[model samples]
Target: MSQGDERGYGDNDPGGRSDDAYSTLGGTRQTRTRMPRGTDDGEGYGRRPARNSRSLVMIVGVVVLLIAAIAFANQGGGDASGDAGEKKPDAAGAGPTAATGTKPVEGKNGTIASGFAHDQQGAQSAAANYAVALGSAEMFDKAKRDAILSATHDPAVVATLQTDMEKAYSAGFLKAVGLNEDGSTPTGLTFVSRTIPVGTKVTAEGVDSATVEVWCTGVVGMAGDGSTKPVTATWFTITEKLKWSGGDWKIESSSQAQGPTPVTGDNRASTADEIAGAVEGYGGFTYAR
Candidate 1:
């Protein structure tokens, strides 16, 4: 698929950043795990004032955007919460972004969640979980990738996706992204690629089919002891066409778009070591209602 094509963006999208692009989501945010530009004594305002200038510019820009956003929020009543006159994401139990305390599915197809309810919330949950799997570090491996496709995609799409995904994550492609032919990182480096779903919405729903859009933030690339390619995060939305097949929601097709990206914050970027430690220490969430 081409950059803005209907199907999806694969090797054609930039540097083939997404290993599982064939049946998976896309991302474009890139906050690398590296240090800021150095400020040396020999270099003052005369050295390179660009960093300082950019910082100040970003500060002003954010302040203005913040003011405008607050005003807009005030005008828009509490939304999605179904709180009569309110219109905010955090309104109440009806908040689309907030968990509704619904009983989570008790089934699992391998490590991926399965056996979702036959409703809108179920579809949303399936889409969100699938997004995480498709954007995960596990997708780098052929076997794990296949398992994910088998578990999440419609059976009709499984075979073709397996082939397309193989091409998308070819050996050369893996090497280009700082991974071995087998998709393993160098001795001391950690390869990071994980998606965190922020929210889900059912755009189109029916008796047996639903289209869900999952907003996600993902980190990818290599981080660790002497890695030049530090891990970076990207924001993207994945639109999945799902069908209630075989007693559960199965993804029929999926496409990704750049973002609903927010403004970059002033928070300092973490170092490669810190990032590696965090990824190693933290585990992913299994099921969410």
Candidate 2:
């Protein structure tokens, strides 16, 4: 559309061939009159000639039915395979990008997703979820961190994790990150710490154990107009050695390292309030492979 003439109708129409222009159809040059709406075919009030009304209705009906039939055919024509005659992939899933059709675990241990299936796919899902819980801002709070560890970790490792995390989130560390000693944000600033899993891979699996790697991206720091600790995104991968304990996959041990990060894009970053609002408003999902 050209500027100031976007609507090509009425007053804003970009003028094309005028009505008096000679026609080129059938190798003839006959001048024709273009009648205004409601006056075509000598009929008034936006109507066509009564004699041709049946033909017009039939034409329109045929067009509509043809369109409908074509749409119906197209709806069932999606086959992500080599040829129309080839057998399609399984309904559950196929290929790297396909949805597995596997339902996520329905249980939650405290606020974290739990009770994953005893399979490779289930281990991947658990690793992703455990990464989110472990990277959350709640880990800076003593009680909530304990709850999170107990929910996500193996029974033998919860106490050890609790002790390590307590030292990791010391009062001095909280002050350095512009958070209060209790993990709460100061008067007006919002503390943001959230991890989102980008992808998960099951490296090894056994009858009752698995090792899954979750590639994650996260934002952490204070979000306020002029806060010193503006939120920043970090990329990392967490390798979790999981055990199928008590009908669910639990984190026996986990370690994180620098990422398989991608090159940065040129998109403009959002402001503090926008980031904070997004962090608070967005709800996470229960993932399944």
Candidate 3:
């Protein structure tokens, strides 16, 4: 979704009030309080207290440490012998951006895609594609959910994750999201729960294991004629710890954090009907690195 529109994760109010301020996927809000200004009654700086000797010493010590740290950093490990064999990342590729145009996985395991190369780039591609599958509406169905778990997660984590997901996507959650207990939307409505990865980064890596973080934007809600839960977007980052298993990268564990969100855009939001039409018209993709 474009900026300036309400960037959020919940249903919209038909009254045109943006309830979009609330995060739908269980997010916490933090508030910062500024220190109040001191009295300005023109006291004319009457009391000039002497600075504490301990505080001054502490400040000097901190400055010394800062200078030392900067000097050490500039030396890049302060070693005479450099690691000439190590590859340095370009400044451009070192930041958040799209894929490096690496080819996607070549195989599919059941409905889920597979056969990713056994490398850091493959780990990123697997994580991106797995994020899409795990965040899809199909995950609400038991059969599809099982298939997804089998395809993405390490065998050791699959059972535990299945139990956890069954609890997380309970009847109460389903109802709140405007889905039936069976995880189906109303006959005329379409349930939207799609994640689009904006970028991926390898956090930690080893010969056979890697941790990849996928920054994502997603939409979730029910779209229909009179639906209160109109589709709305959210921003989050999912970190997947992957293992090279049987010649393919598989997720060992995954966790999600709130966002690297931008300020909301000014675009006008569409109605429920329009949202439904758009969801039906546009199809999702299989993400790759």
* TM-score of every candidate relative to the true structure: 0.69, 0.66, 0.66
| lDDT for each residue of candidate 3 in 209-273, tens digit (9 for 90 to 100) | 77666777676666778665546565666566677887888876544445676676655566667
Off by over 4 Å in 1: 1-101
Scored against the true structure, residue 227 in model 2 reaches a CA lDDT of 69
Q: Give the whole-model CA lDDT for all candidates, comma-separated.
A: 0.58, 0.53, 0.54
For 156-198, candidate 2 gives per-residue lDDT tens digits of 7667556645654567656655677776789888877666667
Which residue pairs collide in model 2, if any?
A: 38-46
Which has the higher TM-score value, candidate number 1 or candidate number 2?
A: 1
Instruction: Please give the lDDT score for candidate 2.
Output: 0.53
lDDT tens per residue, model 1, 180-199: 99888789998877777776
Error of 1 at 130 (Å): 0.2
Worst 10 residues of 2 by lDDT: 1-10
Candidate 1 lDDT: 0.58
